[model samples]
Target chain A: MKKTINIPLGSQHISLLEPVRFKFECENEKIISVDSDVGFVHRGIERACTTKFKFDAIGYVVARVCGLCAITHSLSYTAAVEKLLGGEITKKAKYLRILLLELDRIHSHMLCLSHTCENAGFEAMFMRIMGDRELVMEIQELLTGNRVQFDYINIGGVNRDINSEVAKKIIENLYEVKQRVLGYMDEFTNNWSLSLKFKGIGALSLDDAYMFNAIGPLARASGLNIDVRNEIDYLPFNEVGFAMQTQSEGDINARNIVRLHEILNSILMCENVLSGLPEGAIFTKLKGKPNGEAIVRFEAPRGELMYYVKGNGSAMLERVRIKTPTFASIPVFSHIFVGENYADAPAILASFDPCLSCTAK
Target chain B: MFDLKKYRKKSPWILHYNAGSCNGCDIEILASLSPKYDLERFGVINTGNPKQSDIFLVTGPVTYRSRERLIELYTQMPEPKVVVAVGSCTCTGGVFRDMYNVEDGIDRYIPVDVYIAGCAVSPELIIDGVVKALDILEKKSKEMEKPLKLFKEAISENGVVNRRNVALKVGEVHEEN
Candidate 1:
C-alpha cells in the first residue's frame, strides 16, 4: 500500500527542538521525500552584521548566531579580523583557543549524544550522559565565565587567562568526564537495540560526503579525512598531534562512533594543550585599523565553520559573511535520508546535530 | 483504577516546542535537564516525539505562520496533556510583541497549564515550574471521573443565571441563538 502520507512537523512542532518547518512525504511510515523550509526565524543576522554593527562588536554579535556553537563562530570571526589586522597572537593564546574549542566539541557532542539517545527511547542513557555532560559545562563556566557561549576569545587574544587555580579544576573535571563518558560509551555501544537502530541506517558513502563537502566528524566518519583542525595551520592544533577518526560504514552508527572518538580526541587535545600551556601575552595592542578582507575556518561542534570579514579601516566592518556547518549539512541531508524509514529520520538528522540558528545565521 | 501517583512519577516527559523566539529559551530549557540542575532525579526527560511526551514546553510567542501548526501539534498530542509556556516570549510575547508576524502568546492559540516567566527563563525556575505542573497533573488525574458533572453542578450552584445571560449574549452576537 504505497499511499501518500503527509507529515508536516515544525513551524511549531513540539519535538523539533528548533524553530523550523518540515514537510515529510511518507509512504507507509517510510519517508519518501523531505522538504525543509527555513528562514521563518531569520532575523537578518548577516544584514544586521554589516549595517548596524562595528567590527569590534561583531565578534559578540556573531557569537550570538548560534548559542551552541557560539565559541566557534566568535573564534572564526575574530580570526578573520585578526588576519586583516596582521597582529600576531601569542602561542599560549592559540593553545588556549584550541583547548577551549575542544572543550566546546566535548560539550556539543554530549548534547547530541543525549538527544540521539532520547530519540532512540533510551531515556536512562540520555539522562546519564547529560549528568556527565554538566562537568564540561562547569569547566567552561570555571574558565570562560559562561556555561554555553564563552565570550573569552576576543580580537587578538583571549579575554580570560587560564590561571593555576582554574587549570587544576579543569584538569580534574576532564578526567572525571572521560571516566563517566567511557561508561556511557559502553552502554550506548553494547545495547543491542541502539546498535541495531543506528547501524547501516542513513548510510552516506565517502564519495557523497566529499561531493557535498561534508567536514568534521560527519565527513571523517564516512572515511573522508577532511578535519580543519589537522589540515589548517590557523592554530597550533597540529603541535598537540590531534588524530582524526574515520569509519567506512558511513551510517548513523558510524557518525555516532566518529563523534564518540572525536570527543575522546578532544579530551586528549585539551589535556595536551593544557599540559603544554605556553607563557606569553594573551592580548596584543593593535595600533591602526584593519584595511583588508580575510577568511578563516574553525571546526565547530558540528563541522567546519567558515567566516569572511572585510574591514574598511574604520570601526565599522565593510562586510561579514558566515558559512556554518549546518548550512553545508543541508545538501547532504537530502542525500542521506532518501531511502531511510521515517522512524530513523529524527535520529539520523539529530546525529549531525543540526543547529538551525547556526545554519540560518 | 490506575495508580495516579505511580504513573505521574514514572512518565514526566517533556517535548520542547519553539514557536519563534531567540535561542536563549532553548538553551536554558536543555540546561535544566543537564547535570547542573539534575532534573532527571524528578523523572523528567525530554523526548523528540510528542506521541511519547506528557508535557509540552512551548517557548517563543506564537507567530502568524506558526498558529496553524501550533494548533495542529496541540491536537496531535494525546489526552492528559500539559502545556507549559516557558519564557516571557511564550507567555506574553516578551520583546517580540510588536513584531508583525508574532501573536501575543502561545495561550491565544492553545491552552497553557503553567507559565514560567523570564526574559529567557533560568533552568532552576524551569525545574520549579515543572514541579508545579506535576502538582496540577496530579490533581487533574483524580478529578477526571466527574469533570463535566462537577463543572455543571458548580456553575448551577454559583450564579447560573449570570453565566447563562453571558452565554446567551455571546450566542446572540455570533447569530448562534
Candidate 2:
C-alpha cells in the first residue's frame, strides 16, 4: 500500500521572487500531482487600464504589468494604439525600439539564469551572473533615464535617442557581457555538480510542449519552433540578426542553455542595431484619437506577450486585455512538475522563470 | 556563550513577501542582495522562514487574495521585527491606488516602519531602507528586552490598568514631583 504526502511551496518562498503557491502531492519522493495558485499578485490591471488610465497614458500604465518585460508590454500596447490611429513611426525609432527590446531580453534572461543557479544551490554562480547583469543595467540606464521601468517607448515612437557616446558605451558593455556569457556557458555545460542538479530534471517533451501550448524558452527548449520575434513583423528583428535558440533535452539545463544562447543572440542584435542605426527622429506626433480595435503581439524575455486594445473616439479605452507569457505557460508548468523529485521542485520552478505579477495582472 | 541579541543586531535575516504590486520592487530588492549592491555586506541574508527572520521587506500594494498571507507572515515572525515597504505602490499605492482588487498598500494589513519611495525603488534606496530598518530593529529589540511593572494607582475608573496611562511611571523611578 502506498501513502501520499503533500507539501506546499510559496505564496512567499526564498526561491520565488513573486507570490505564487504550489501544492505538490508526493508518493515517497516523487511528485504525483501539482496544483498552483498564481492569482496572488493580481491587482486588476486589465480593468484599471480601461477605467483609470486614458488612451494616451495607457502605454506607460501597461508597462507596470511586469517590470522585467515592461518594454514589451508598452511596445505591444503602443503598437496596438498606433495601428488604430494609423501612424507610421521613423526607421531610427524602430531600430532604437528593437535595441531596447533586446537589451531588456538580455537582462531578464540573465536574472532568470542567476535565479536558477541560486535555486540549484550554486550561490557563487548566482552572485557572478547577477554582478555581471549590472553591465546591461548600466547600458539601459544610459539609454533610458530609469533602470527597471524605462518608459522608453511612447505613442508614435521612442522617448529617448542614442548618441555616438552612448552607442560606444553600449558596444563596450555588450563585449564584456558576451565574454561573461561565454564563461557561464562553459560552466553550465561542463560543471558536474550543476549538471547533477539540472541535467535530466523537469524535462518537458516536445509532444507535451505542443499539447500544452508552451511558448518562449520553455517551448524552445523542448524543440518547438515558436517565437513571436520570428512571427511578428512590427519590429525589424530579422534585419538586426535575431536568431531563435533551441535545445532538445527540454530539462532545466536545456532551458539554461537556451537562455544563455538567447542572451548571446540578443547582444549581437543590440550591437547590430547600435552600429547601423538609421538617421531619423526618435519620436513622431500622431494627430487624433484612436478609434477601432487592434491586436499586437511581441516576444517578451520569458515568452510571447499579447495586448488587445479596443478604443472609441474618446479619452478612455473601451477594453484592454493583456495575455502574458507566464499566464499561458502555467498549465505546462504544472504538467512538468508531475514526475520530478520533491527536492528539485524549486529548481524546476525557477527554471520556468514564472512571473506571477504578469500572470495575476 | 555567544550573545544572541548582539549577533542578531550584527546579522539580521530578512523575509521578503510580494503583496500585490508589479514585480519591479521585488526584483530591485533581489538585485540589492546580489554582489553589485552587496546587501549581504551589512550582514543581511534573505531567509524563507518567517520565524527566523528579523526584518520583513514587503513589496507591492496589498491585494485582496494576499492580505491574509501578508498578515500571516507578519504574525509568524518573532517579536522585535521591522517591516519595510519597498516601492511607490507599496508605500502608498502609487499607480495601483484606485484599483478594485488592491488594498492600497501593505500598511493596510500591517504597520510599515520604513517606506522607500519610487515607481520601482532602486537598489541603492533598498539598501538605505534596510540600513534604517536595522537601526529600528535594534531599538525594538532593546524595547522588547525591558521589563514591565504594575502600578495599582494607574487603574482607570473602569477598573482596567492601562499601560499607556501608566506610561513612564513604570519605566522610571519618580522623585516627588
Candidate 3:
C-alpha cells in the first residue's frame, strides 16, 4: 500500500488566478514533495516575438505577456531596444514611465494581497482590497487611455503626455489611496486572520531564499537585499524616494506586510514624479534600427523581469527572449511548499503571487 | 413546486476558465465581481465547479494543451449555459494569433454566444457582456423548458413500431400554430 498520496491543484482551481498545475505528494497532513507545471498558459510568445512581429512592434506584443505588470514588460523591451539604438529619451518621458511602473506595482501588489486574503478565506477583505485597488486603476486610466493593459511605453519614450489638469486628478486620487493604505496598514497589522494566521504558515528562511536565488518581494520578505530597482541605472528610481521594503520572517504574513509597505513606497514615488513634472517632450524619434543585442532588467510587480532583444540591423530581429519573475523563482516556490501542510497550500501559493501567464509565456 | 428554470436566472453562477490568457482580462473579471463594479448584484457568483455554473466566462486564446480541457469543461457543464468569450485573444486570438501553440480562438473549440472585445476587457464591458449573456441564458432556458408535442399518431411499418410524427423535437415551432 502506498503511504504517500498525491494531490493536484489547478490547471483550473478556484483559488488559483491562472492555469498552473501543482502536484503535491502528501503524507498524513504534510506535503512531502512537489511537482509544478507552469506551461498551461504558454502561447509560444518567444517564438512569435522573433518570427512574426518586428522589433518595434514587439514592445506592444510583449506587454501582453502578463496583464498585471504590463508597463514593466513593455518598458523592459523598450529599454533593451533603446540600449541597442543608443538613444536617450527626455527626462519627462522617463518620469512618466516610472510613474506608470509604480502605479502598476501598487495595483498589482493590491491584487496579490487581495488574492492572498481570498485564499485564506477572508472574502470580505478580498472585496475591500479589490475595491480600493480601483483608485489606482482610476489614475492609470487618467495617465493612459486603458485601465489594465496600458500600452504607454514605446521604444523611444512613453506614448502619452501628462497635462496639469490630469496630473491634479491623479495626485488627488493617490492621496486618497495613501490614506486608505494607511488604514489597511493598521488593519493588516492588528487583524488576527489577515496577518496573525499567516505567520509561520509557509516560511522560507533568509538563507534558503538566497540559496534558491529568490527575487522581488519573495526574497525581500526573507531579509534579502536584492531589488532590481536599486541596481538598474536606466531608470532614476533612487531619485524619486524609492526605498526597499523588507521583512525578516519570510512567511506569508511577512510577504503581506512587505507588499503593503511597497505599495506605500510606490504611491510616494508616483507622487514625487507627478509633483516634479520635468519639462521635456514625451516622445523622441530615434533613427537607425537596433543592430546588436541588448539585455535589460526591471523590477516588475512580482519580481525581476529580464528582456533580451537581438536585432540584425533590420526591422525584424534575430531573437527576442523574456525571463519573467515567476519563471526565475519557481525553484524557491517548489522548495517552500514541501514540509508544509496540504491544507495551507493555497495560502502559501497565493503569498508567492505566482503569475502563471508570465511563466508560461 | 418551484420552477427551477424561472429562479435559475435570478442567481447565475459563473465558472471562469483561463484557456491560455495573460492575466489582464481575468483580473478585470475579478474586478467586476468586487464591490466597485458589484457584478454580484446580478446574483452572479464565481464558482469552481462546472456542473453548478450557468455562465462559462472564458479568457485567453485556446492553447493546444488547454483545448481538450476546454471541451471537457464545456461538456461537463449542465444545460442552458452561456459561454462568454472575454477579450480579443479569446475572441479571435488577438495578439497571440498565428503563434505556434495557440489556436485561432475559443470558438474553434466551444461555441461562444457573447463576445466581449478589448485587449483586456474592462469591468464595464464585462458587465455589459454578462447582461447580454443573461438574456441568452434565459432564452436558452425557455427553449429547453418547451414541452415535446406529437404531430401525428404512431405508425407501425414492417413490424417496426415507431412513431415518426411523435418525434417532433422539443422547442421546435410548428408552421400553423
lDDT of 2: 0.90
Question: What lDDT tens digits, residue by residue, belong to model 1 across residues A39-150?
Answer: 6554456776767677887787677667677788888988888888888888888998998888988988988888887776677777788878888888888898767556
DockQ of every candidate structure: 0.25, 0.71, 0.78
Rate residue A61 of model 1 by lDDT: 68
Ranking by lDDT: 3, 2, 1
Instruction: Write the residue-wise lDDT of candidate 3 on B60-156 in tens digits.
Output: 9999888888899999999989999999999999999999999989998788899999988999999999999999999999998887554645788
Candidate 1 docks at the CAPRI level of: acceptable
True contacts kept of each: 0.30, 0.91, 0.87
Residue pairs in steric clash, candidate 3?
none
Cα RMSD to the true fold for all candidates: 6.0, 4.9, 3.8
Candidate 3: Cα lDDT at A174: 89
- Docking tier of model 3: it is medium
Instruction: Kindly report which residue stretches of model 1 are placed more than 4 angstroms away from their true locations once superposed.
Output: A12-15, B1-15, B20-24, B34-36, B40-122, B129-177
Q: In model 2, how large is the Cα lDDT of residue B119?
A: 80
lDDT of 2 at A311: 87
Q: Candidate 2 has which clashing residue pairs, if any?
A: none
